[model samples]
Target chain A: MGAEVKQTILNRLIGGIDAMSPRLRLAAKYIVDNQSAFGIDPIRTSADKAGVSANTFVRLADRLGFDGFDDLREPFRVSLLERYDGSAGEAWLDDLSHAGAFAADHARTLRNEMDIVKQSLRLLTPHKAEAAAALLTEARNAYVTATRSSYALAYYFHYVARMSLPHVHLIPRHMGSPVDEMVSVEPSDVLMAITFPPYSADTIDALRLARRSGMKVILLSDSELIAPAIQADLFLKVSVQSHHSFSCYAGAMAVLDSLLHHIVTRGGKAAELRISRYQSLREDFGAYWRAKLPRLRRE
Target chain B: MGAEVKQTILNRLIGGIDAMSPRLRLAAKYIVDNQSAFGIDPIRTSADKAGVSANTFVRLADRLGFDGFDDLREPFRVSLLERYDGSAGEAWLDDLSHAGAFAADHARTLRNEMDIVKQSLRLLTPHKAEAAAALLTEARNAYVTATRSSYALAYYFHYVARMSLPHVHLIPRHMGSPVDEMVSVEPSDVLMAITFPPYSADTIDALRLARRSGMKVILLSDSELIAPAIQADLFLKVSVQSHHSFSCYAGAMAVLDSLLHHIVTRGGKAAELRISRYQSLREDFGAYWRAKLPRLRRE
Candidate 1:
C-alpha cells in the first residue's frame, strides 16, 4: 500500500466519529499527534497524557478492528522498539555509526533488488526460462563473457555449464590477440554477455560484434537501459544497490544460485543416466585411461 | 554464552526457591522449552498449556530480575517469531512459521559475516594494508585473477583499484596461455588470486606459476585447504557457511568491502592527496569536455 492511502485511512479512523466511538476517537487523535511519545513512555502513561481512560483505549482497539489494545498497538510498539538506540563499542563509535548506516542501506538494497525481481517477473514471458534452458541443452559451443562486475556470474555459469556441454569458452580479459578466439562464435553457438554499470567499453563492443556475427545472445545487466533487451534472445536485468557507493550482490547471487539449482534439478535424471553410461564406457576403455591415471596406478 | 552457562544461570536464579516457587520454576522451564508455541499463541493460553497460573509466570519473571513477565518473555517471543521453516511457502500458517526462521537466518548470516570481518581485521597487520597500498601505488602492472565464484569480488576490487591505479589487468577467463601472461609478470608486479571451493584448478595453477615467477601474490580463498597459504605474500582466508550446502560469499564480500574501506580510510594524507588529484583530473577530462570541444563539420 502507498503511504498516502495508509495515511488517509489513519486520518479517517481518527477523525470520523462514525468510524470510532467518541472517547476512542480522541485516543486515536492523541496517538496520531504524539507518535514519538509512544517510544519514550509506557502505554499507561501515554494514555494519561492523552486524558483518555484505559477503558476508552480498550474501545479504541475495537474501533481499530483489533481484539484488544495490545493487538492494536503491538505493531507500533515493535517499530518503536526497533528504533531504539543503545550505543555500544565505545572505542569505535564512528565505525559503529557507519555500520548502522550500512545496515540500513543493506536493507534498502535488498528491497530494491526484490523490486527488480518483481519487475522482471512481470515483464518476462513465461517461456523465457524454458527457452533459455533449451538453448543451454542444445548449444554446440557456448561462450560466456562478462566485463567488470558481472564477470564472476558469467564465469560460474560457464564453469557449471561446461560439466554438461561440449565446448565452452570464457571471454578474455585483455583485448589483445586473444580476441581472435571469439571469431569462432557461430550461429549454432550461444554467447552470454554479462555487464553492469559502469559498463566496460570493451565488453559492450565485444557483445555488439558477437550479436552482429549472428550468435544467439543472452544478456544480464544491472539496469534495463544497458540490458540489450531487443538484440538478445534472452535478457535478465538485475539491479543491485549497496549502502556504500558500491553495489550489493545479494539478489544477484540469489538469482544465479536459483538458476543453477533449477537447471541441475531439471536435468538431474538424464544427467545421472548419462554419467552412469559414461562411467561404464570409461571402464570399457580402461587400458587407455590407465596409461595416464596416476592415482589408479598407485592403487 | 554456552548453553551450559545459561543452564547454570537458570539453576542459580531458582536455587533458593522451595515449595511455592517450584511451580514457577517449572513454568519458566516450560516457557524456555515451548518458546515457539508462545510466539504463535497468547500468554494466557501458554500459561494454561504449561499448567501454571499467570501469577506464577509473573513471579518467575520477578525471580529472573525482570520488571514484568512481558519483559522476560519478549526475547523468547521474538526468537520464536524469527525461526523460518523451509516448506512454509506452501501454506500461510507454514509461511508464518518460516518467516521467523528466515529472519533468524538473515540475522545469523549478518553476524557470521561481521565476525569474519573482525577476524580479518585482527589477522591482517597494519603493515599488510599499508604495504599493499604502497605496492599497488607504485606497481607498473597489477593483474587480478579470480575464476568461478570468486570472480565478482576480484572484478569489484579491480574496478575500484583502477580508479586510482590504471595499470590493473584482470586475468583472461580461459586458461589458454596463462604462461604467456606470466612471462610478462615482473618482480615488481602484483598478482591477486581469488578462488573458493570447489577450487578452480586453473586459478590455482595461475597462482602457483605467478609465485614461481617471483611476482608478489595476494590470495583470497575460502579455506587454507583449497589453495595452500604459501603461494601468496599476503594470504587471507574467508570461510562462509550457510544452511544451504553450497558456500555463500557473504563473508568474503563483507571482508573485501571492509578492506577497501580501511585502505581508503587509513591510507592517510598521501592517499587523500592522490584521491583529490585523481578527482580533479577526472573533472578536467569529464563529460563537459564534449561540450567544451570544437564541433567539426561532417565531410
Candidate 2:
C-alpha cells in the first residue's frame, strides 16, 4: 500500500463518517475510536464488540474502497508491528472477565511489566544512557513535558530531578500554555519528553517547538517508530503495554529512575553537594516522618 | 524483648543526640537519617557509608546503655521484620554499584516487584477486594489521602475513581491544610488512606481525625503492623519493597487498578454510563492523539 492510498482511505473514513448507515457508523466509530485495537483485534471480535455483523464490517470496508476488511486493517496492523513490541494483551483482558481471575490478571500484568523492563534495559545501551546523562548534566537548563496518562511519570521525574539539579522545569508552566513555556527554550537547554500511544499532542507540539529552537530533545516513548522520534536528539524506548485499558507505567518509571540515578552518580562533587543539601533541607522540613516503633524487650 | 526497653533505647538515642562527640554524632546521624538502612545494613557497611569507624557505632551504642551495636540495631531489625516482606535489597544495591551491572539491576528490580505483586495478590483476598469495592460503590462520598512518595499513587487513584464515580475527593486540598478538607467528611463517607514507612505523620493525623468523625477508614499499607492499621475499618496490605533506594509501586498500582476495576465492573449500568460518558468527553477534548501511520506495502 502506498502513502497516498492510506491517506485516501483515512480521508474517506473521516469525510464519510456522517453519511454512513447506522450499522456502518457503528463500525466506523469503533475503528476511529480504537485505532490501536483495530490494528490488533480480529475482525470478528471487533465486529462483535461494536455490535455490528462481520458482513457489515466487510460492507463498510467495501464502501470505503478497500478490497476487503483485511485491507482496511492492514495499515493498523503494520503500524502496530512497527510501533509496539509484544502482543496487544487482548488475551489478558479475556482472562480478566472470568470469575476469580483478578489474581491471574495481576500476575500477568506484573510479568508483562517485568518483560518490558528487561527489554528496555537491553535496548537502552550503556553508551546511550551515558550520552543522555551527559546531556542532562551539561545542559544549562532542562524542561520535562508529559501529559494525560504520562503526567504522573513526568511529575515524579520532575519532583526528583529538581532536588539534585538546578533549573529543571516541568513545562507547560502549571497555569500557562505549554507553547508559551516552549517559547523560551534555547539551544543550550534540553527538553525531556515522555509520551506513549496514544501520544499526547501537547507534548508533541512542545517537542516540535523546542526542536525548532535548537534545544536538544530527549524522547522517552514506547517505540522509536513514533512520529516524534525524527525530532529527538536522543530516543529511548520503554514498553507500557498493560492488560487493562490504560498503559502500564512500571517500566517507564523504572527507566526514568535509572536515568536520574545515572545522572546523579555520573555527576561529580557538584551533584553530591546538591543531593546532600536537598537531604538536609528535607530533614529540616520534616519531609520524612520517623517511624514510631513500639517498645520491645531487649534479648 | 519487651516494649519498654525498646522505647527506652529510642528515647535515649533521641535525648543524647545533642551531646555526643563528633564521631558518635556521625554514627547517630546515620542511624537517624537512614533508620530503614540501619535496620537492614551490616554495621561495617553502614559505618563505611556514614564515614565513621565501626568502633564509633559500638561506642554510640554503649553510650546509649546498649550491650553493643547489635542491641542498638535490634529494634530496627524487629520493626523491619514485622513491617516488611523480603530482604532490604542490600545485595541489589551492591549489584548496582558494579560496572556494566545496570541490566542485572533492572532485572533484579523487576523480579523483586513481580514477587511483591504476587505476595500482595495472595494477601488481598477476593472477599476483601469485593468488600472494598462495595464500600466505594455505596459510599455517599469518598476521600483519598497519601503523602510524599505515596502521593503519586493516591493522585492516580483519585483521578481514575472520580471519572467513574461521583463525590470522590483527594484529601488535603492542594493549597490548604489536609485538616481543612477532613472537616467536611461525614460519618457516611469513606476515607481511603494510602501510606507506607516511614509513615507520613500528616496522613496518620488525617486518619485519626476521620475516624473521630465516624467515617469508615480503609487502610492500604505495606504491612498490617503499622500503627494506623489498628484504627482501620478495613485494612489491605500490599508490599512495596524494591531492589533500589525507593519502594517499588508496581504492586501498589496493581492493587489500586484491581480495586477500580472491581468497582467499575460490578457497578452495573450507572458505572457503564459514567465510563462511556468519560470516553466520549475524552475524545471530544482530544485527550487522546490520533495515530499517524506511515503507509506500508501489503504483503
Candidate 3:
C-alpha cells in the first residue's frame, strides 16, 4: 500500500510540479526523490529533510487536493503498515543523524551497510540477474556509462568485464558526453547505465538515445519508479541507503558482482579462455608485482 | 594463531622467493596471495588454483627448507583451524568455481557478499574506525590514492570527503604517478591508499614516500599484513572475497562510508555548513535534474 501511495504521489507530483510555486516544486521533488521519507518520518521531519518549512507541506497537500497534512500522510500511513510486515531495511533508516550518523560507532555503520547489501541483494533476486545476464551474453556489444559519483561504479564493472569480455566498453571514450559515443551504437548493443538521485542529464539523454536506437538497456540504480528504469529492458535495483551523508554503493557493487558471475556462466568456455589469457598476458608482461628480496637475489 | 602462521609463511616466502626457480617463485607468490588456498584446498586443488603442478608445491616447500608439501601444509592447517574457529568468511571461499560460480544463484552471491561485509566489519572494529577517523580529522589535508580497480574506492572517498572537507584530494591529479604527487606532502597531511592483491606499484611507492616524508598513513586493503599496511598508522581491513571471479569491493565501500560519517561528525559545524552550501550551490546552479512534464508545461 505504501508503494502504491508512493507511486500515485509520484505520478501526480511529476505532472503538477510545473504548475506549483518554486518552494512547492522543491518539496514535491524532495518527496518524489526520497520515496519513503513521508511514510517513515513525521511531516515535520520530512519537511526538515526536504529543507522546506512544515507549512510548505500543508500547502503542497492543498495543491494536491488533499485536506491537510494528516490527510496527505494517511496513504503513506497505510502503506507504512504494509511495509512493516516486510521490507526490513527500506524505511527503518531515514536521518541516521542523531544516533547512527554522528555516533562514530563502526559496528552500527557496518550493520547499516550490510543491511543495504542484504536488501539490495533481496531486491535483485537471482531471477532478475539471470534475465539480465542473458541479455548481456546475447548482445553483440555492451556499453557502460555513468557520471560523477556513479562513474566509479560503471568503471569497476567495465574494467573487470573488459578483462574477459572484449566487447564491453566504457562510454564517453573521450571527454565529450555519453551521447557523443552513442553515434555508432546499434540495436544489437546493450547499454548498462548506473545513476542515482540528482541524476545526471547526460545519463538520461544516453538512455533516451539508447531507446531510440532500439538498443537494450540495463539500469543499475536506487529506484525502479524513475521513467528510465520503467523503460529499461532490465532494472537491477540497488539500495543506496547508508549511515553516512552519501548514498552507499556497496549494494550496487554487490549486484554487479553477481551479474558478472552470470555473464561468466553464460559465456562458458570462451569466457574462461579469455580470462586465462588475460591473466597470462598480465603475468608475462609483468603487470603484477612479484616478490622481490634483495638479500636472497644476491646469490 | 592462524594469522600468526599466515604471517610467518608470508615473511619466509618474501625473504626466500628470490632464490627459488621461476616455477617455485610462481608457486610461492600464489601461496602468498590467495593466502589461505593451501589450508583450504587439497594439494591437487591448490596446485590447480596456483596453475602449477603438485610437484611445484613440493619443490617450492623444499626450497623454503620444509620437508615436503605436508610440512608446508601443517602450518596452514593449524592456521586454518584457528581461522575456522573465529574468522567466518576468510578461508571458506577459496574457490567458488564448482558450485557457487556457474550457478545463477543471486541469493548465494548476496549471501557471499554479506558474509564478506560481516567479516570485514568484524575486522575493522569500532576502535579502528575511531582511530582512523581521528587521524583523518587531525590531518591538515588527506590525500586518497589508488590504481585501477582500487581507484574507484579512493575516488569515492575523495569525492564525498571534498564536499564537506575541502582539504581532501585524490592523488595523481593529472597523469603522473602517485609518487609524483607526494613531493608537496607534509607530516600534517595524511595519505589514505587503497589496494589489494596484485597491488599497484604506484600505491606502494606512494606509501613509502609518505613514510619517508613523515606523512601519516591509513591503509585500506583486504589484509593488514602487507608491508605498506604494516607501516600505516591505521589500517582499515576490507574483505575483497566474493562468489565471483573478481574481488568484490562491497566491504571496502562500507568501510569508507563509516569513516566518512566520522569525518562529518568531527568536522562539526564546518562540515554542516560546507555540505549545505555544496548542496545549495548544486540546487541553485541547477546541477540536479528536476522532473519535467511537457504536457503539463504547455501553457
Name the best candidate (by TM-score): 3
> Model 2 TM-score?
0.59
Clashes of each: 9, 7, 1
Residue range B47-162, candidate 3, lDDT tens digits: 76656678889887877778788778777655544533332232222322233533425445666777777677667655687888888777898899998878877888887888
Which residue pairs clash within candidate 1? B81-B100, B82-B100, B82-B101, B83-B100, B83-B101, B84-B98, B84-B100, B84-B101, B85-B98
Output DockQ, candidate 1. Answer: 0.05
lDDT of 1: 0.53
Give chain B TM-scores in order. 0.55, 0.62, 0.60
The digit string of per-residue lDDT tens for model 2 on A157-191 reads 77667766777888765655567776666899999
> Which CAPRI level is candidate 1?
incorrect
Ranking by TM-score: 3, 2, 1
User: Which residue segments of model 3 deviate by more than 4 Å?
Assistant: A1-105, A227-230, A280-299, B1-104, B228-230, B283-299
Considering TM-score, which of the candidate structures 1 and 3 is the better prediction for this target? 3
Give one digit per residue, the lDDT tens place, for model 3 in A1-299: 23435556778999988898988988998877764446445678888998899999999998888888877776654443222212223232222213453332544565567767766766665558788888777789999998777888888888778766788999876477899988888999999989875566778789989988999989888744333222578878777765444687878878888778778767778887887676555434333334453211111
Residue lDDT tens for model 2, B1-299: 22223445666777788898888888887876665567656789899989998888989888877888888887765534333222233344334435566544444444455446545554566667878987887899998888766776787788767777778888765655566787677899999999875566677777778878999989898744343223578889776764333456656766776677667666667876886676556544434334344422123
User: What is the RMSD of candidate 2?
Assistant: 25.7
Residue A286, model 3: Cα distance from true site in angstroms:
7.4
Candidate 1, residues B19-115, lDDT tens digits: the string is 4356876786675565445444456877898898778877877877789867665654433322211111223222222346533333333333333
